[model samples]
Target: MNYRIILALGAFVPAAAIAQDQPAETRDKTSAVISVGVDYEEGSYGTDQDIRSWSVPATVKVQHDRLTFAASVPWRWIEAEGKGTIVTPDGPLGLPLFPSETQVDQRIVREGLGDVTLAAAYALPVKVVNLSVSGTVKLPTADEGLGTGETDYAVGADISKTIGAGITPFAGLTYTMPGSSEGYERKDGVAVNAGVAAQIGKRATGFVAYQDSASTSDGLPDGQRVATGVNVGLGGGVSLGAYGSAGLSAGAPDLATGLRLGFLIP
Candidate 1:
């Protein structure tokens, strides 16, 4: 070997070995997503006349590896001239009592901030099937006209199977334990949802789902609903989703529609 080349090689090899002995710290892999949307629902909700409801909701979700956390709240407007109780998308929160024989001239609309909800979920990394478990808490933050003014809790599990080309079948089940209200003691309820989602092209996807929930109180029937929706990617980490639903039973809304816009942050 040439003398100068050997000297250069000797110096370089020790530096390379020293560099291999130390490793840089790994970065934290946490991400967040925010979403806002408006929803409208109409039905009797087991009342004498059709009641229309609307809500504007905002949510923040965070994820780190397989764990996820989220918080959501909504501003609600309810046409409650004939509504007795309201079971929101956040689950049952209100059990308002109105005299059935009250004069129609005395009716008034109810509007305010609805209940605030928090949730956490964890997924297990597995092949063939994906599985996750979650828990949720509902805080009483609304006036008595809009909510039961009580806290509630739920635990749930979700399972999904992914097939070829972005088609997946999924199902979830939740059990809720509700708090009591004056003259109307609530009971635990069970909810289940199943669906198939298909990826259409690169920027859009579609899904159809069925949902059902057991009644949490007397005089209220079981809720059944079917829905279809589409989600489209708008580039730059933004997306939009729209959905429509129909009630399969009297316990659910006769018709409902909603849209959500979401942004992903790294």
Candidate 2:
């Protein structure tokens, strides 16, 4: 109970980083946004058994001057032959590892809130590339069935350059340090992303990204994924987005898809 309160409070902390790639001149514009989305993913995680999960998330973001603050949390439902919930922004990464065993396998059907993620991004002014630095904290607010119930921290930097033909190329690197857990001997990990975005139509944009993440613990394979998304703007502060992704390696999900709806206050 006490830890739950701490997790809720920690979510509002401005310690996490988010990427803000807007023009430097428009960084000072004050704005607020609310978004909601649902995602579903299925994978074997190098095991014979399959794990399927659904995540419904709500997010709020506010920008003041050049800094943006955001918080997001998800309600997750998982079905698998597993004992661990272990939810993260990247989704669950196989079952937990016990001190005695590298990984545990058991029947699991769980549903609840996973964790709360807090972030803040500070945009750096540059004429050529838009650069931003930020960090992230995942607060464990859910029970063992939904989360690891341990706090996690990460920091990252993003750089992007927009060139001719409304195309932008971007790259980012993030380092994550998982919190201590009883059975799970979590480890520090790094993830890298490279992507290119282009305008597809007057109101639509498309992007393709490749992501790779090091293993975070024993028995979990490294993650390699390819993802794509399309976003379209509707007049009057409304936007819609859709995404699809596939895993290229063992630890990543086999397939995932999601849709997002956003409203902006200017």
Candidate 3:
């Protein structure tokens, strides 16, 4: 999975706030946020070898009135073994042929900066519903093969409604424009996610979400994931959160986990 996508998904949770019915003059507030998190995932992309990755991402967000801006950067480590068969089209019968019995297995490890992402969002409130529209861009910063060397872009929207008991249910849709690399071709795709978040006591919240996406490249499969997590307020405008996700498809990771610390400035 792409580390940049993971970061964007993380951002969606806290950023999808429902606007309360307040006086027009009091609906706007200026705030800033800083968040740091570490994520880990392991999966086999329909291959025999297992791929594992770890990332530490830090993000800064500023919101004023109805506009929000965010930027995120991450340091990532990826490890995998290259033991799969190498198919060649130069066989005698014009058929693809695998490597002979003389090939050796290789281990690969890459650790360095991951992609940097920037996003802007605008919120519109209509009665009891809040709608957000956002756009994001991913900059190529990782090592040659560690990340997609091309820039990526995406546009998305979220709709949320705050019900009674301090519970908010939200749904989002995103369309991604995948970038092209030297030897790979990408396809545009869409993803959908829905979840409900409920306040637990006065300073804590719990949430459960489900996400599904279409294939973003040829030969890649679609994905489904379910996640549950909790955020606990630590006072002083700070909070800590932990979450875990389970993949429900071949294209998704088997399991993923993360922890985050966030600070809000008003």
Model 3 segments beyond 4 Å from truth? 1-26, 84-104
Instruction: Give per-model CA RMSD.
Output: 15.8, 7.1, 7.6
| Model 1 lowest lDDT segment of ten | 13-22
Q: Quick one: best TM-score, which candidate?
A: 2
Q: Please write out the lDDT profile of model 2 over residues 4-109, one tens digit for every residue.
A: 1111111111224355555456766888878888888888766555778787878888887768788888887877764444333343222322111225666667
- lDDT scores of the candidates, listed in order: 0.64, 0.66, 0.64
Best by lDDT: 2
Better of 2 and 3 by TM-score: 2
lDDT of 3 by residue, 173-229 (tens): 778786766556677777788878787888777788887777665555666778887
The residue pairs found clashing in candidate 2 are 16-120, 16-135, 17-134, 17-135
lDDT of 1 by residue, 1-266 (tens): 00110110110000001000001131136767788888888777564665677888787877776667777778988775443333332334344444344545344477888878787777665555667677777788876577777888877777677678778776777787878766667898888877787878888877777878777777778778887877778999897877888889888888888887879898
Alpha-carbon deviation at 236 in model 1, angstroms: 0.7
TM-score of structure candidate 2: 0.85
Q: Least accurate stretch of 10 residues (summed lDDT) in model 2?
A: 1-10
Per-candidate clashes come to 0, 4, 0
